[model samples]
Target: MNRSDATLFSGGHKGAEAEFGKLAEKFGINEVNFTFEGHDIERKVGLKILSPDELKKGDVSMDIVSARMGRNFSKVDTIRKVIQSIFHMVNSGYQVFVVGWILPDNTVKGGTGWGVELARLFNRPVFVYEQDRKAWFSWIDNTWVEVTPIISHKTFAGTGTRNLSEDAKNALEALFERSFSES
Candidate 1:
């Protein structure tokens, strides 16, 4: 199979890479890059990336944006830099997979969270913590949705290294496959 042009926009943690690795293997994906973890004030701010379809959906990719920018622009100026990077990816025809880690407490707020909201705002598919199995789910919904009752195995175990509980793995695989497959 030909290598797919894909990038995993992770929250930046240890276990998250496991899942990313699995995704890479499943689809022969290229490029696994992490998002920014610092809150610098000198970065530019705006929508991260713009998809070709975005011209019709009026959506923008915020996959590389800083969530803190919405709250910390008062102190940090890194928003534009983050957003611009995201824009560069989208405009360049690369599909960005926004990933969020599931917290042990059944929450999506920890470990560099961004996927759901970013996907929603950008009108792109998202991979999030599977509420029941600790695996990740693709957000194909029109609006942002968060899963509850987080599973531990999928969230803590990096992808490709362990069993991903059939359902969870399937969901993630389907999203990635469908995104790049030509109809």
Candidate 2:
């Protein structure tokens, strides 16, 4: 598979997002990190700070979001920008990959979960490296199925939890290697 033209759209925050940006740099793939002012993110290589107007394009009712995810957001106002930024990332990428825990309730944990939901709503291919399970799972037929995912799409999104585990870090590295390593 050719990775020369691969582009990763990410939030570029700490943990998995930062790791993804680093790996994209290592493999010479283009990366775009969507962020807004006052948002603290670790990766700055491809920062695209969205203006207030741009952010408004991605906005939706927090009540609707909570209804879709089957849960309420603690601080609706503060997390609004993050949801908007994620909208840009997922909207740009045809595929979504993440590193986080999958709860028994079937929803992925934290803010990253919103991305997964958006990807599903968009009908884009979504994969998550379940931290506790230590395996990759793809959203298929409304279920999480174990699979070994590679970067097949020219454009993809990488994101996940801030509390990344060592195993999850290695999994992300392996994913890049498997996708970009020369035959």
Candidate 3:
């Protein structure tokens, strides 16, 4: 696929990043972006952690409310950065993939819910790996629908190599194939 068919893997820091990184590499996708915090901001095997400065450099197209708040940054800065980064990636023509743990409240952890919401809002295809449930879900009909059987969740701690179920891999691969072919 051409560079225009690059993919963006969005998730919070920790195990999700590692999982997404491995999946991107496994699929031979060279361009992927996501958000990271603290010491988890290092470069991964196949993904780039978008920095706050990078977000400021892009055409964010949002009114940053804290622009006049001096250098006293807050969660607003992080929120703006995340939103702008996702917007920039999509605007630059990247297909978005999401992976994260779903809370008991059914919300995604690590701020990944925003990515999923953005994908839905923009009518883009999204493949979500519900880590907590060990299920593969596809964004369809404006909702997440399980596309595969539930599997056992790995009990690994922190960010380490985690394997996605074969069904999840296949579904993601099919999504990528369909996206690249359309591009």
Q: Which candidate has the highest TM-score of all?
A: 2
Candidate 1 TM-score over all chains jointly: 0.38
Ordered list by lDDT, greatest first: 2, 3, 1
* Model 2 C-alpha lDDT versus the unseen true structure: 0.92
lDDT of 1 by residue, 28-53 (tens): 55433323435222212211233334
**C-alpha TM-score for every candidate:** 0.38, 0.96, 0.52
- The candidate, 1 or 3, that scores higher on TM-score is 3
**Count of backbone clashes, every candidate in sequence:** 17, 0, 0
Return whichever of 2 and 3 wins on lDDT: 2
Better of 1 and 2 by lDDT: 2
lDDT of 3: 0.47
Model 1 residue 156 lDDT score: 18
- Against the reference, the lDDT scores of all candidates come to 0.38, 0.92, 0.47
Candidate 1 off by > 4 Å: 7-12, 22-27, 35-107, 133-183
Write candidate 3's Cα lDDT for 1-183 as tens digits. 353334544332444445544544554545344554543443355345656666665433333323322122246655567556555444443344555655454444544554555555567555566655766566677456887422111110112113445554554455445544433
Those runs of model 3 whose alpha carbons end farther than 4 Å from true positions after fitting are 1-13, 34-40, 44-74, 92-94, 102-107, 148-183
